[model samples]
Target: MSNNNLIKGSLQTIILKLLEEKDRMYGYEITQKVKELTAGEIKITEGALYPALHKMEAEGLLTTEIQQVDNRVRKYYSLTKSGKAEMSSKMNELHAFIDNLHRILNPAIDPKLNL
Candidate 1:
């Protein structure tokens, strides 16, 4: 599996977290921010990003604003009230998932038993 595949499941959580940090962001800006934050370890492609954004918008988890920038219209996304609540829930779930994965990957053995 590719790195993109690994990021696929966490994409929603990632996007939610980013938007939580920033009030609003455009598609390209989001892709760039993820690259910068991850130090190029993960790259979010347009194909993957757009569909996710659209789905979230349809689900009322996101609200969009269109603005004119240099004669071009850019759509910026911000979390709705529902989205904020969802973000908190998703963040908690992601944290628990990471903790579980860490435990499974680096399990601790009983000191007395030394198994």
Candidate 2:
């Protein structure tokens, strides 16, 4: 499993990107999907996940719907219209940040050189 410190900053990006592709997902479903995607390298705790979800909802980046599922209520989340529009830019920004970090860590590679 990856360190929580490393995973912390990118959680929002990860969630947003997943929602961008999956259309809609519930909390546990999101956790499971992320685990499946990363092959168990990353695990999102409920403590971290819900706060982020709620914050995003408050920020208008996500919307939620509560559904009755087998005697339980499941809150499903999906990206809003504004969130969809922001996806590309957010992804690009993330990629650029990673690339810069890569260059900083590996002195032999020039970030300016398009690969």
Candidate 3:
């Protein structure tokens, strides 16, 4: 399976971090940024990303601003104060998860092999 597929649980954290670093970002930009950062390993799909953005906005974790771009009104999302705080906790959780997974998955690495 392609790691480009984001696990739903961690998606919110990644989105929040991106928005936190940048003042605001539009949906496609967000998708592209993640794709680029992951070296194309993780591709965020419109079907998944849009609904997540909407849900985050509805939950007050994010807020949107709109401006006309190329005759189209594009919505940009930014993190709310709560979102900023949440990012720290989420990042910690994600790291813990990855560390735990690593230990579990590679319990018997050959000691001599330099792998």
Least lDDT summed over 10 consecutive residues: which range in candidate 3? 1-10
Pick by TM-score: which candidate is best? 2
What TM-score, to 2 decimals, does candidate 2 have? 0.92
Candidate 2 per-residue lDDT over residues 21-109, each given as its tens digit? 99999999999998999999899999999999999999999999999999999899999998887777889988988888888898899
Candidate 1 lDDT over residue span 1-39, tens digit each: 237777999999889999999999999999999999988
lDDT of 3: 0.84
lDDT of 3 by residue, 25-99 (tens): 999999999889979878788988999999999989999999999999999899888888788888888887777
Ranking by TM-score: 2, 1, 3
What is the C-alpha local distance difference test score of each model?
Answer: 0.91, 0.90, 0.84
In model 2, the Cα lDDT at residue 108 comes to 92
